[model samples]
Target chain A: MYRVALRMLLGDKTKCLGLVFGVAFSTLLVCQQMSIFFGLLGRASSVVNDVREADIWVMDPSVKTIDVPYPLRALELPRVRGVEGVAWAVPFFKATVQVRTHQGMLENAIILGIDDASLVGVPDAFVVGSIDDLAEPDAIAVNPAGFRLLFPGEELDVGRELELNDSRAKIVAIVDAAPAFAANLTIYTRYSLATQYTNNGRNQLSFILAKSADGTPPEVVAERIAARTGLKSVTSQQLRRESIMYVLANTGIPVSFGTVVILGAIIGVAIVGLTFNQFVMENIKQYAALKAIGVRNVKLLFMTLGQAAFVGVIGYGIGLGIAALFFSTVPKKSDALRGFYLLPEVAVGVAILAAVIVILSTLISMRRVLTVDPATVFRG
Target chain B: MTTATDTLAVRCTGIHKSFGEGEARVHVLRGTDFDARTGEMTFLVGPSGCGKTTLISVLGAILSCDDGEVDVLGHDLRALSSGKLADFRLANLGFIFQQFNLLPALSATENASIPLVARGESVKAAETSAREMLESLGMGDQVHKMPAQLSGGQQQRVAIARALVHSPRILICDEPTASLDAATGNTVMGLLRDAALAGDRSVIIVTHDNRIFDFADRIHHMADGVITHIESPDSSREDAP
Candidate 1:
């Protein structure tokens, strides 16, 4: 009977394809939009994620997100280091500065200043030169994406010269860093050199990156520092979440992406419901004949559900495949789309949503089949 | 212990059925009495809206009569719940429709195998039996052809095969030949009579086509929701009210 039901669905190629297209279109829209949404959230905290060695981040009390940071006084570093369970604390400087490329092109670049003595906040991976080379005179490391932006047609190599805030700076390495939300070039240099370049007021500390003494959880140490120093202190994970939450609270991204997701679901239900109802209506006489010939309503229900399941699976598979192909290829070719890919959790969520769409449509159509008078078969 | 009437395939008495309510109510079947014997073909013949179809629907257990003692193959149909009635139909009854009602997606063999499949037989085994039945009806080469590919007579033959596939105890047909030409109609009636009248099986046909009247052992004439009279091919007509 299930086989017969599937044959009935597949018999009308046009209608079957229409149903598949409806589900597939819904899936593609939901998955692609959700991937981009999550990817954007990830980029919001990309700076914090890149500095893997820091377990706790100490910032000014007013700071809410990494992108919009309020610099702390330089003395906040020693204060955080004096707190209990603090092994060491390093001064980290972050400020956006204007850069003049060797080609005389002016662009905005974010400068991350790590400790001059330890270089503890630099990204661990490098594409061109070694991390030790940051010790060179006026040395800095540029992320690969930033390097491409600064050099355009040039291959990745160190020893490029650029002007930062009217001061000469030399790129000693090409670092691998997560793409930033602002889509700006990222430059890493020593804290002292960065302070010299930026020349902000004496309060130049962006954040204090701290490591908890062994066996002490970062969350506990973070609470201690905040209580003692009257500053905002949070674990690295907490900061990442805060960063994403700040974007959600302050930006229009959620409303924009949320509207598309809702529209996708509505369109899916409408398409599947109407198309399935029409398919059932067109074959109503045959269903009545089956009913008259002794098919129980339960059996008819199974047949309809089986048809819905078939279309749901095929449509979801095709849609997910297309979404995966987009994530796999598009991000590689486009710089702005970097770090965006389909998440497994998002895929699973979309699948459950697709099932709901199919089942809801099938139930609506089944009402007609279940109530059809078998006596109608006798009338004609 | 069974008497002659006890062995009858279907028996109905004072069957009352109506549609609508209040002033719009219309009585479709009123005090209708009908019976068919085993191993014989019974025809219910009447003009349109004369209650022939309603009487057969009651006998087939596809519709409930407002008031009646309805029995088929020794089981009282009015005593059965809807689920049990469906079970009884699946186990003991078969139906043929005017439209053939062959699923256009399935081949002739698959269409003919529905009864057996509905009765819990494996599809493979059901199709094997259906293939033999279709072949016996001289449709061996067209077993795999879809319904649209077959002629009207051939489609009716497949319908007949479907009706008899599970070897049902009672076979009910509604205008089985209404869509066919005279020659094709006669040919289909011949196949139904030959293939369905074996083995204590009762075949009841509700049709308006007089050309196939000679194929029935008994013809029950209905008018205004009641059986007016009964006629036998071997004897003169008998009047019953």
Candidate 2:
């Protein structure tokens, strides 16, 4: 009987293809949009994720996201260092500056100043030069992507020089830093050199990066620092979550992506429901014949469900394959699309949603099959 | 020796059935009494809307009557629930429809195997049985063809094979020859007649085609929701009061 049901579905090639296409289209749309949405959210907190050594970040009380930092006074760093359970603390400076390339092109760049002694907040991976090179006078590290922007068509060599704040700066290293939300050029230098380049009045400290002692959780140390210094302190993970939440609360990205996902589900339901119903309607007499020939309604129900499951699995497999291909290839080929990939959680969630769409459509069509009179088969 | 009443396959007394209600009410079966004996072919002949199909539906246990004593193959149909009734039908009865009602997607052997498959037989075993039945009906070369690929006579042969594949105790057919021409209809009727007298099985058919009247052992003429008379092809006709 299940074989019979499958044959009946496959016999009508057009309707079967239509049903599969509806599910596949919906799965692709929902998964692709959701992956991009999560990818963008990840970019919102990329800076926090890149500085892996810092367990705690202390900033001014008003800062909500990593992109919009409110600087704390220089004295607050010593206070944060003085707090109990604090293993080490260092000054971290972040400021936007304009860089003039040797070719005379000007672009905005983010300058991150790490502690001169520890180099604590610098990116760990370097593509061109060693970390020791930053100790050289007027030396700085630029991310590979930022380096590409500043020196188009140039090889990733460490000898490139740029003018920052009318001061000569040499790029001694090309680091593989996590991409930022604005995708601006990122330059890393020593704290004192960064202060000399930026004129931001007296309080120039953007954040105090700290590490908690052994057996002390970062959240507890952050609370102690917040109570003692009267500044906002958060664990790295907390900051990453807060950064993503801030974007979700303040931006239109959620609504825009959410609308596409919802529309995808709606279109999936409409297409599957109408096509499945028509398929049932066209075969109502055949169903009646089965019913008259001693096929119980329960058996018929299972057959219908079997057909729905087949369509759902096949369609979802095709859709997920396309989505995975997009994530694998597109990010590597385009600079702007870098760091965006499909999440496993998003894949599992979309699969459940696809199952729901298929099951809902099947249940709706089952009603007609269950209610048809077997006597109608006698009516010719 | 088995008496005619002792071998009765179906017995219905004062069966009443109706459709709709209030001013639109239409009574389809009005206190009708009917019977079909084992080892015989019983034909119910009537015009459209005269309740021949309704009576057969009741005898087939696919429909419920308003009030009646309905016994088929020695079991009281009224005592069975819908689920049990379905089981009984699958175990004991087979049906042939007016349009043949073969599933278009299935090949002739697969269509003919439905009753056995519905009764929990494995598809392979059922198809094997159906193939033998089809070959017996002279459809040996058409077993693998789809319904659309077969002629009307071939489709009807497949339907007959489906009806007899399970070796049902009673076979019910409604308008089995309506869609076929004279020669094809006669051929189908001959196959059905052979199936009826082969064993203790009883075959009941409701049809309007009089060309094949000679195939029936007994014919019940119905009018206005009641059986008007009974005709024996080998003897004199008897009128009802």
Candidate 3:
């Protein structure tokens, strides 16, 4: 009888495909949008990810996210390093500045000042020149994608020059880094050069990136630093989550993406509900025949639900494959979407939503089958 | 009134049923009494809307009467709970329809195996038994062929195979050969008659086909929701002049 259910569902190719297409469409819409939304949230914390060597970050108490960092006193850097369990600490500077392209087009660029000695806060890899080239006079590293954003359709070069704060700055290498949530072009420079380029007043340190000693948790060291210095300190992971939470609470991203996800669910219900109802109606006689053959109502109900589940799984598999392919392919064409990916949790969430859709629609379709009078089989 | 007896495969008394409501209400069956003896093929012959179909449905326990006593094979249907009644039907009764209502998506053997499947038999075992039954009915080479690939006669034979696969003591057939040609209809009735006389089993068929009445052990005539006459084929031929 289970085999019977499958054959009945597959018997009508056109209606079967219609059901599959409806489910796949909704799954694609929901899953793909969720992936992009999570991708944006990941970008919100790219700064935290870029400073991977640091296990904790110390900042002014008022700073809520990397995007809105308030500078701490330069003396606080050593104070953080002076805390017990602190392995090493380094001063990092972040500030938004305007840059003038060779074409005279001005755009906002985010300048990240890594420590002069260890280069602790720069990107992980360089696509062109090595990281040592940043030691040259007025030299900075630009992300390949950020470079494209600043000079679209231009080849990557080792010595492209841009004017920042009315001072000459040369891009000596292309770094591979994720774009920030704000989509600002990124420039990596030495801390002392960044101070001269940005013209900051005294106490120019925006954050102090720190590492915990071996065998000590970063959260423990962060707590000690916060208790001693009267400044905000958090583990790298906590800071990343805080950044994401800040955007979630302050921006309209949740409402916007949430509305689309709900719409996807509604579309799934409408398509599966109507077509499955119609399919049951068309197969009413067969159901009556089964009932007359002494098949219990519960058995009939299971058969209907089994058909819906098959459609749901097949549709979800196809939708997830398409979403993964979309994430892989679409970002290559646009510089702004370089590091998007589908998360495992988002896939599980979309699968749950699809199951809800199938179960809800199956209940609606089974109502008629449940109340069916087996005597109807005699009418003809 | 017919008392419960081991010789009777089905017995019903004062069966009542109606359809629709208010001004559209229809009294489809009015105190109809029916029975089919074991080891006999009983035919119900009636005009349209005469309630023969409703009477057989009550006997098969597919539909309950408004008020009646329905005893099939020794179990009082009204005394059994609904679930028990369904189980009783699965264990004791087989049904065939006029249109050869085989599921088109299933192969001939799969369609024949439905009764056994509903009876909780494993599918592999059920299809194996169904294949043996079909082979006995001269459908050996057609086991895996779908319904559309078979002739009308072969489809009806597969339906008969399904009805007999579970070895039920009683079979209810509604217009079993109504969709077949004259020769095919004769062939199907022959199969039903053989099934009835094989081992003290009973076959009750509600049909209007007169060409096959010679195959019945007894015939009941109905009109306007009540049985009007009963006839044996010998007496039917004696009164033919």
In model 1, residue pairs whose N, Cα or C atoms come closer than 3 Å (at least 3 residues apart or on different chains), thus clashing, are none
Q: Least accurate stretch of 10 residues (summed lDDT) in model 2 chain A?
A: A177-186
Ordered from best to worst TM-score, the candidate numbers read 1, 2, 3
Kindly list the per-residue Cα lDDT of model 2 for residues B1-241, writing each as its tens digit: 1113348899999899999999999999998889999988888998899999889988898899999899998898888898888888888998998889899999999999999988889999999999999999999999999999999999999999998999899999988999999999999988887887785788898988888888888889998899999988776798853
Model 1 compared with the native: what TM-score? 0.97
* Candidate 2: residue pairs that collide: none
Q: Which stretches in model 3 have alpha-carbon errors above 4 Å?
A: A73-87, A103-106, A153-157, A200-203, A213-217, B1-6, B19-27, B122-125, B135-142, B236-241
Of candidate 2 chain B, the 10-residue stretch with the lowest lDDT total is B1-10
Contacts from the true interface found in each model, as a fraction, amount to 0.75, 0.75, 0.64
Return the top candidate by lDDT. 1
Candidate 1: misplaced stretches above 4 Å? Answer: B1-6
Per-candidate TM-score against the hidden true structure: 0.97, 0.96, 0.91
A109-133: candidate 3 lDDT, tens digit per residue: 8898999999898877888998899
Residues B50-128 of candidate 3: C-alpha lDDT, one tens digit per residue: 9988898888888788887888888888887767777887888888998878888899999999999888889999999
Q: How big is the positional error of residue B200 in model 1, measured in Å on the Cα after superposition?
A: 2.1
For candidate 1, give the docking quality class from DockQ. Answer: medium
Report the error of model 2 at residue A337, Å: 1.9
Q: What is the total number of backbone clashes in candidate 2?
A: 0
TM-score of chain A of each: 0.97, 0.96, 0.96
The weakest ten consecutive residues by lDDT in model 1 chain B span: B1-10
